[model samples]
Target: MSKSEEASQRPDTPHYENATGGWGSLKGVSRILADQKPTFGAFRTLMRQNKPGGHMCTSCAWTKPAQPHLFEFCENGAKATIWDLTRERCTPDFFAEHSLTELRGLSDHELEKTGRLTHPMRYDATSDRYVETTWEEAFEGIGAKLKELDPGATVFYMSGKASLETAYLYALFARLYGHNNLPDSSNMCHETTSVGLKRVIGVSVGTCVLSDFDHCDLILFFGQNTGTNSPRFLHTLKAAKERGCKIVTFNPIRERGLVEFADPQNPAQMTVRPATRISDIYLQVRPGGDIAVLAGLCKRVLELDAERGSTILDRAFIAEHTTGLDELEARLREVSWEEIERESGLRRDELNEVAGIYATSKNVIGIYGMGLTQHVRGWLNLAMLVNLLLLRGNIGREGAGISPVRGHSNVQGQRTVGITEKPENVPNDKLRELFGFEPPQEEGRSTVDLVEGLLDGSVRGLVSMGGNLARAIPDRARAEGAWRGLELNVQIATKLNRSHLLPGRATWLLPCLVRAEEDMQATGPQAVTMEDSLSMIHGSLGRRQPASPHLRSEVAIVAGIAKATLPPNPRVKWDEWTGDYGLIRDLIEATYPDKFKDFNGRLFTPGGFHRGNAAREREWKTESGRAQFTAPEALTALGAPPEGQEITLITLRSNDQFNTTIYSFSDRLRGLSGPRDILLINPEEMERRGLSEGQVVTLECAVDDGAERVVRGLRVVPYDLPDACVAAYYPEANPLIPVSYRDELSKTPAYKGVPVRIRTDEAGA
Candidate 1:
């Protein structure tokens, strides 16, 4: 059998399609708690997952209310906490028992759940094990490698999960070292929002805050699984529903989160089990076809405007605060109804129904997720959302604007605190003022570009501040190979992951403090600041003991490396900065003065203060000095596959998964358990492809690159998805996607839309 065919054979697990949240979530929480078997020490970490004077859930960015409930967390949130705060340890002894080849063959869940790294380790290629090493030796080893390479050849990849304090020092060290190759997790998720919002609105930040959900006349949700990905968001959505606001959704699959939800917090929901209908109009959209559905709505709005004039379309606001409407309307009017129906997988009447709800509502808040951003035309999706809201005069209103939900708890905060590859975003003059050095002026590389650099032999060293970059990127095999070819690799993480296994010529595994662990520094127990999806910056102070005595804070790790690599009189006070985290915040405030004014006082604010949004106050800071109605002059090129390919593949997160982190093997909503080796295919398509339930199959990429990218051992399962749109778990299927498949504008991998061919694995038979 071919390697691809051999790779396709694996174990089997049953899937259970069950209701999301409610009693099930309670049971899940109980099971996880029992798994932790939290002693008083672990119990202390559990109670402080998301409370005042305590750390927020590091899992999701759903912010806590100013007056939050005593328990403002969910089952998944508990999983993230206990997983990070686990007593289990993967010490050097464990590494001695497992070889590199042996560890690579383990499932992602098994590797992470094995537990946190107890000490620093250096890969011993001779023995194929990671042996314990002193902190000084590890730093010196990494520092020596850094001194040998051009700073530009070193890539400092930052995870969105890194705290503001850590990100500040990481970016500072890289810039001071004369390079800006700081790619972040945003490149894989919402970089489109930052690019698109800045193109349309004056700023990349969201205009709406959490309170806007309370007063919105309508809630338009697009492709977000709130129940699983952001369970706390269900509270806001349910509240909107109870207020008589119309809710509409556009998704490729009918997510249970959108269909119906029972508030786990409400006592009545436990017994009555009455589901609050979330979406009044749920349209099953086709992958990468959101534009057509949105354009159809806008086209309908134009027809209404033609009949009764622009009053229903916010003419006054359009005239006063926006430009490009005539161009937008002209293009929208040209779209044919047939094309809309065909591309969107919905009829004209169904669209007209949504148009009716949208046309009548006075205030609307648009919510979207990776579904909108991870596409070839992902930025256009955001543009469409902005155009929809702009047409309705939703900006600068009581309950209106766009809300782009983000994943990691502090992904936005990383970008906010100088985690960018674009030199234009670095504010060189400000850095010169704060650090007494001219920052590097050259533009840096993003994640995709970093992979390209690695393959082309430019990136020599890598310092990843949390994340399994090797498994997280699209082309896993290629990413794995390129990183292994690097001269040096350093990973600062809370737990062991696949990236650790991809050792360069020299590899160092350094464990860092998680959000729950107490961070003591020269000043005192340090507090780190984080920004949420809503652009609220607040404090996160650790309270629990360090998971391992040898573990260091991310801030300390960065400082230690900086001390080893840089000159004796490096202008920045590395020791002082690490000693007091408040100094880091003070430096940040100095760097971005206007944005961080009163930063200290606001850290103690009830729910953190807003970071100043232009659109929120009806302030337009664009070159035209007004919010603009942005519409594409024409439809983008079709992203569909050619004659050979029949299926469109989407990578999905099971209810138990968090990004690339496999929290559990079972998925609550998908009814999948034990194994994540199955693919969700449309029943009719499965039969046509000569496949059966539990029958192993191989998925082949259909691109014309002359490269056959295939993933094997996929257990087929019939599902309620759009025809020819199959779903599978990522990192497993990551190898099947080419790294070249990404958004042109934002450079984000188009994880949602991969064209592939499926065939039953009758190879050896």
Candidate 2:
């Protein structure tokens, strides 16, 4: 039989569907509850998610509305909760049943399915197993290792799931330990957004709030899939659509959430009517083509202004609130329509049509995610989007601005509370006054920098708040190997993950409380705070009991580490802060009084308080004192691939996954089931290459690092994507992305775009 014919018999061929978030979404939630069979009341716990004074969903950073619905959680949120509240425990006996070598062979999903960690454990090198240890012993050993090494040589990593209080304590603890080597998940996902927006608008975050969508006339999406990444955002898009907002999306694949959505909240929409159409216009731009598309939009807008008596351009806003218009205009004028169309995989008229839509609309909101940020020119990609918005003064106005959707529930919050590698970003003077210590001024290593340090023996220790760092990062061949050779590795987490298997010499696994579970401290049941995507700070209080008796709160864990590593400071009372989380809020208020005045009292209020973004009020915190328009020198930063490896790969998240956590082996939105090791390519591309469905192929990266960087046994499945653009799940595809290949400014690994060649894995077949 022919390869195509033989492959056609496979059951998991790629399928496209238009509907998302109706019955399918509800079914997804039900499946997780049925499969995991939570020991705790899943529905009861879910009812409290994202509600006032209830624990925030540990899934995504999408903000909660002023008045939330009866149920304020999504399908993925349910999975995260159920996963955390699982009945199965990874106790010492469970460890005794599985050795380190045996555990290392399991996939990330399988490792997590083993269940929530129930006790503190240390690597017993003699038995090759993680034997249970007392918390005092674990902390003492970790502290001793830190005392033996230079503080600068140890890196502290924070995951996006950390609470504001936990992040604050972690940051302070690292500072007290005499180094600023702190890196978080943002360094890998949205660092470009932070770096680019700060340079252009003086703020490192997005300008739009959730309510802004209610007033926006036009909403443009670039490289973000809301259905899987942040399902709550679909309601925002649906609301905007119902109000006659023109939604335009530019993505390589037509995402179901962006095209149509069936709201589970609305009974009529769920049971009576068809799915609501979300996007008015859809542009399937080629991978790494966002820059060219953005430049083309600007070029067309300029043309419309010239043709229509300069009415299309917001000249007044540009004259008063921005600089470098002349440079931007000249650069746009120089860009040829042919080049724009060729690079963007779009025609001149399509670009003109979108530009016309923008011109007609009074207020526009530009929304994007990692697609625009994970590139070699990731910073440039965001800068171009900022320039596009600046043309018509979309920023600093109601219902109009740039919204960069963040992944982690507290990723932005972590950065807000000083979990950054850059020391200058922190209020050093306030820290000195509050903690009575001279904070480190030297810049610390970012995630990318830390990985390089691991290889060079510069960084010997890693203290993570929570995350599967080994799998999340790119260039795993070097990173995972270097991880095993570390002198000390400490992971404070709730569940077992792949990162735990790559053991250091003295690895310690510290069990901590999750968000859905109550944290009973010395004072009473403690509540933690989180800052959502809109910069709103709200409280998260858990109602369920702790998953394990041995588990401690993240705040207590950080405080314990601090007390053990540093000498007692009379000014910094670690024990007192751990007892009462309110004291930590008071300290945070004292440190950043302008942002968090009356932090304790205000947190009790419904929907929390806005942290106040300067850019939203026409206040630029940049060097120029105004929003700046930067003209990109090229259409895109992506160069030609090597002769054999022609396609560019963009890593993505499945519907069943959040970050590195996989709940199942299915993605219903894309008709993928039972496997993640499948590549989605365009039918035309597949035919041209003489490839077939279910054909095993190996994707090899185009980098000369003296190591063979490839992901083997990825079956080919035809998908709806632009030519030369293919899609694969993240972390699996992370191996093909070179560590050195990243945005120069942010150092974020190019997870969105990687040049690679495909080879038939004959041996695997």
User: Which candidate number has the best TM-score?
Assistant: 2
lDDT at 84, model 2: 87
**Candidate 2: tens digits of C-alpha lDDT, residues 4-112:** 1222112334554547898899889888778777975757889888988887899999998878888898878888998888887788999999998999899888889
For each candidate in turn, the TM-score is 0.96, 0.97
Tens-digit lDDT track for model 1 on 388-452? 88987988888899888899999988998899998888778988876688789898999988888
Q: After superposition, how far is residue 514 of candidate 2 from its true place, in Å?
A: 0.5
Whole-model Cα lDDT of every candidate shown, in order: 0.81, 0.87
How does model 1 score by TM-score?
Answer: 0.96
* lDDT (Cα) of model 1: 0.81
Residue clash pairs of candidate 2: 645-757
Give the best candidate by lDDT.
2
